[model samples]
Structure formats: C-alpha cells, structure tokens
Target: SQQGEEDPQALSIQEGENATMNCSYKTSINNLQWYRQNSGRGLVHLILIRSNEREKHSGRLRVTLDTSKKSSSLLITASRAADTASYFCATPGTGGFKTIFGAGTRLFVKA
Candidate 1:
C-alpha cells in the first residue's frame, strides 16, 4: 500500500540460475537504487538507475526501470550461494533528504 513495495517477498534458487525481483513505487522520482544486505551485515549499494534510463547493468546484475509504470526490476545472473541475501529497492523521498526502501526480497541460493 505504501511506496516502494516489492513483490515475491522470498525466493529460492539454485546456484547458477538467474533470480529476479520486482518493486513498485508511487511517485515521480529522479532515480531508483537497489541494495543488497547479508544477514547481520550492512546494506551494499548495488545500482542506481535514473528515471530517464530504461536499463542499466553492473557485473552480473541487470536493472530495468519503467517510469510509465512506476516499477523496477532487478535480475541477478548466474547466482551463487554467496549471493544469498536480502535485496531492497529505494527511492528518494520528498525533498530528497530521505530514502524510502521496500520491504525487500529474501533470496536463498542453494549450493
């Protein structure tokens, strides 16, 4: 019901398979960012794709944004057991001083 809500709250995949997660937000944002956090660890910035850009990639990660639909998706290719973590999608809040994060998707990569 709130902004930056992610779907498929949990996912399990075997090593070497691709994992996908989706997030939907309600607002006009200049950019969207994705982050990964391991259990008991800090969040790591993954990627920040702008509103004007449709797609961006970093390493084995791919991010796609659709301003029209106010949605974004993250794809991890060739997932490894080490990649098991919680992924979150973030967007800047009013005045750009705050960041709203989605509930996050928990990924379990089995070896």
Candidate 2:
C-alpha cells in the first residue's frame, strides 16, 4: 500500500522567504511526487524524484528524496503570496496503479 504522511500540517511564511515541507512514507517507493493545490482548485504537480535520485530542482522548487529513510522534502525559494496553497506528496501504491496522497501541508504566505 502507498502511505505518505506530511509533517507540520500548516505553515506560515513571509514573502521572499523560503518554505519547506517534508514527507515520510512507510514502504519502499519507485518515485515520489510533490504537488500544490490552490484554494478551490486542482493539484499542480511541482516535482518528481526517483528512487535513485537524491535531489532535483525545477525553477525555484527543490526536492530531495531519501529512500533509506523513506522520506522526502520540498523547498520553495522566494515565497510569494500567490504561492500560498496546500502541498501534498504522492507515491504509487502496490502494482504501481494507485497513487496515494499525504494529508498535505497548508501554507500561507504573507505579503
């Protein structure tokens, strides 16, 4: 089964600062993905890091995966008010057909 849990259910940061979110899983995973969801909107894929990869970057977003520890972290640089959203981590379940999502971390950026 796919099981991922994100820590710090809520976070508040100021604009121009950095925001960090973490995820921990119970079982081995081939890959992990991070997503952001705006209020009343869809979840936007932020980054994906494979089991063999330690760190990946996209734009201002950085993701690190540690298979040994079964954990991952996402860092958003230069936070903005518009970046306020709920962030989630996902991993494929058994058979690689199901995607399980974490409880998500609600982030609020103050301008």
Candidate 3:
C-alpha cells in the first residue's frame, strides 16, 4: 500500500529562500520521516516526527505532523544552491525492515 505522497511535483527557489514541502499518507503511521537526495547521492535522513509529536526541528529544518489529518510538512530555511535536490517523505512499509517513499519533490535552488 502507498504511504506517502508529496505535493508540488517540483519546486524552484532562489538561494537563501525558504522551501516547503508537504506529504499526505493513506494510512496511519507510527512515525514519519523526511529525507533529501542530492542528485545521484543516496537519501540523507533529514528529520523525523512521531505520531505523538506535533512538531520538531533540527537546525534549519522543521517538521510538523497532524495525525488527525494524516499529513506532514517539511521546511528548509535559507536554502542554498546545494539544497537543490529531491526531497522525500517516508513511512515504514508492511515489512518491518522496509520503508516506503513518496515520489518526491525535486527542488532547484538558483545561485
């Protein structure tokens, strides 16, 4: 079953600007996580927000969750050209060891 679906298939922003991405899930989840992929590189865990937690932050990254809405959002502040990459929201899959990922939002930060 599909878990996370990200909005805004793509995004383009200027360096130093903020970038926002949202994700919606079909079923309930124990925890939701966000990740960033810089082109060919692997996914780097950005932040995680548990169902019980309403919001969490790490550096310039902020994550918010609303269990009632089965949704989550990620915000990146002062984004730079290096921030240009694909961002994905993920949830655990049916298999405990596996994870399901959203299609991702491809972000382009212009220098």
Clashing residue pairs for model 3: none
Compared to the true structure, candidate 2 yields what TM-score? 0.97
The candidate, 1 or 2, that scores higher on lDDT is 1
In model 2, which runs have C-alpha deviations exceeding 4 angstroms?
none
Query: TM-score of each candidate?
Result: 0.97, 0.97, 0.95
Compose the digit string of candidate 2's lDDT tens values, residues 1-111. 439999889999999999999999998889999999999999999888999999999999999999999999999999999999999999999886899999999999999
In model 1, the Cα lDDT at residue 81 comes to 99
Which residue pairs come into collision in candidate 2? none
- lDDT of candidates 1 onward, in order: 0.96, 0.95, 0.93
Off by over 4 Å in 1: none
Candidate 3 residue-wise lDDT, 1-111, digit = tens: 668999888999999999999999988889999999998899999988999999999999999999999999999999989889999999988758879999999999999
Instruction: Estimate, for each residue in 1-111, the C-alpha lDDT of model 1 and write its tens digit.
Output: 356988789999999999999999999999999999999999999999999999999999999999999999999999999999999999998876998899999999999
Compared with the true structure, the alpha-carbon lDDT of candidate 2 equals 0.95
RMSD of each: 1.1, 1.0, 1.0
